[model samples]
Target: MCLNLKKGAIFVADSHFSEVNVEFLSFLEKLKKKEIETSQLFLMGDMFDFISGESRYFVKINQKLIDIINELSHNIEIIYLEGNHDYNLQKLFPKLKVYKRESQPIFAKYENKTIALAHGDIYTPKGYDIYCKIIRNSALLIFLNFIDFNYWLSKKIYNKLIKKSICSKMKDFDSFAKKRLSYYNSDIVVEGHFHQGKHYEEKNKLYVNIPSLCCNKKYTIFDGKFITTQL
Candidate 1:
């Protein structure tokens, strides 16, 4: 059986929360305070600048947002698709459904149409695939955690991440979308990695590259069709 995609569900992608980009923190605050409401929440990832379950230092620094998300999960359904910047999160978020990259393009049924969801990192080159595997390896993360004792190594990495620019427009996005569609057979293809907030029809199939909350200050609401709303 396919998952049910609920109406009024909210989809957030690539917030990239860090010391510099705190828009996601405010968004979470609104959710916690009931300023915004949704029965289903889809976190289409890169939700953090960097994070992993085995990295104690990163987890500790991000504990506040983590606590709020854990609390919210009890009252709502949350589906998180792990992106490159964030993975190994099953232990961190036991209440939510977390899909790792290896298990992506998860299918759901929405209004009799098939919907596919991913973090937009698949169909990548072999080198990137190998890098993703190595980065998410538990042993390597544990070793990094050991080096991050006293927040030394982790702090440097965090500083660099926050300074890096992530917002940019893609060239030839129309062709890019068409090429990407060649890999999927679903009625709707939804992803968030390019940081491009765009939706268009190709071969009668809906393609939605969800907006980056950090870049666009927007998120998407799905009733029958996708609607992008500003913060």
Candidate 2:
């Protein structure tokens, strides 16, 4: 979601962190150890490969990373915009400000410019929209949790996700972004989901695709303009 930037904020996205990705856990450890300093931490989404609040098994699976985040939240202003892969997190990270897909394009002021923040999966087809709603529902999540945690359903889902390729080059991305920006009322749109890690400017409006921390160890900092850097 949107937050006014009083100081530099670290924006991380599409990390797709899981049990296999020890790097993501290390990054959390660094943040917890004060190696990575920031007044604000923006989790742009998909930070977890698959995490839900309803499932105790999934919570235990990522407990180390979750604990680090929970500890850091005591001091840092952490904002989590739930991604496709990571939703239903309100129960998991109660201290952090969690934004769901429907509540996005959260608006904020950045140096006299209005900024909109989202997980970048908005304005999709009607079918996908419905799917998002169903999946994020509390009742549905509880039902899934019953089956997933009791059985080995979580393992099956995790296996499928791990096999899929998350990194890819989006052809004609400028055109795609141009169309997306037209739906926004802000001067700048910052989002992450496509894992493109690219910036685009058109008609004085800026669109930032924040880099994935899992992909090339990339992250972004806002210093007047968004700056992309590697860890």
Candidate 3:
């Protein structure tokens, strides 16, 4: 039976570009086939590896993304949570949906339950790191964006650091998940960034740390009445 999200569902952020295709494609196709697009698509952050106005490939790629949105816009709703990577996209794609952090704290209620969702970068114990913070700051991002060579170099370093962060220099997402859950007192805590796809019942509470759209598949399925699974 097809299950629609009665009170809406959320897809936590982070795109990481190429990582999106392989794993999540099958699941997205499944969601399409299931006629279950009632869930809202919330992109928490880093929707791109880098946004390059000068790169023809980057422009084409974003256009394809826009096409994907147009195709799914009706069946599903979309909201893009502003991330450090998406800063440049505003110039090229001004109309894309974006949210201000102070204005965030979007809600999704299901089966008389509610949860707050975000990229969860600020909440991470080591959250965003020193370099990440510097680059994400408005002034530096603007300066780097205006310079093609600088943007390219910055992209290379950013990818390299992100890889390192994902691999070695990190604490377990479960601990982070639990910590965030403590602040909620709600039914669930949905976060993305650690790229760790996990969710379950513990201590009478639900903690969900969504996996990245990069490489391995990750998505949370919420039927109108219940959460089908976290895949």
Candidate 4:
């Protein structure tokens, strides 16, 4: 679902928060304490390394962070764009505005310029789309939860994810941006996944690849133009 973009909006992407790296939790605390102020909080994607609404086991493991976000939602308008690592969050965050992968690239307006926001995996290969569909299906999640009686499956997946390196530099990113921008119809396209933390313009469209807070503690703030900074 698309919503209006308010000025002074904060955009955080790819935190990939896990038990070992809890900086994302600390950031949430800052927001809760009013240490950070914003009209809206945009969780671009991968906020959690792995979280599924169907599994209570995964939810319990990250309960503290969940609690903080739920509390913050009472006051702040949070728009969560579900990433590859996190999906099926309707039950996890009932109050917050959640958008799944299939319903992404939502439209908004920033200073009279049209904006398209997504988790940045939409334009991937066909195999990726099929994989996403299978993993994001509520029925599949329920089946997985049923088989993970002792949470062994969840533990194994989490362990593998924690060991994988999620930060890196991509080559020919400008060419990639040009291709991706063609799929969107907007003045500005904002997304998080590549962890590129850069901005580019193709034709009349602007593309903002938001940095991962877990990797560099960087985020984007919109004034007249999107500006990246470490918080």
Winning candidate number (lDDT)? 1
Candidate 3 local lDDT, 1-231, one digit each (tens)? 112225556564455654323333444455567644555666666556654443444555456554555456566666665555554344454444555443344556665667666566654345446655565466665565467564475557555745643422236656756777777656766666666666656686777666665534455554442242444
TM-score per candidate = 0.98, 0.95, 0.65, 0.96
Q: Give the per-residue lDDT of model 2 (tens digit) for 8-61.
A: 888989889875555677777878878878889999989989888886777878
Q: Model 1 — which ten-residue stretch has the worst lDDT?
A: 143-152
* Tens-digit lDDT string for candidate 1 (95-206): 9999999999899998779998999999999999999999999999998777776888988989999889999999888888887777898999999999999986877898
For candidate 4, the 10 contiguous residues with the lowest summed lDDT are 1-10
Between candidates 2 and 3, which one is better according to lDDT? 2
Compared with the true structure, all predictions reach lDDT values of 0.92, 0.85, 0.54, 0.88
Clashing pairs in 1: none
Q: Clash pairs of candidate 4?
A: none
- The worst-scoring run of ten residues by lDDT in candidate 3 lies at 1-10
The number of clashing residue pairs in each candidate reads 0, 0, 1, 0
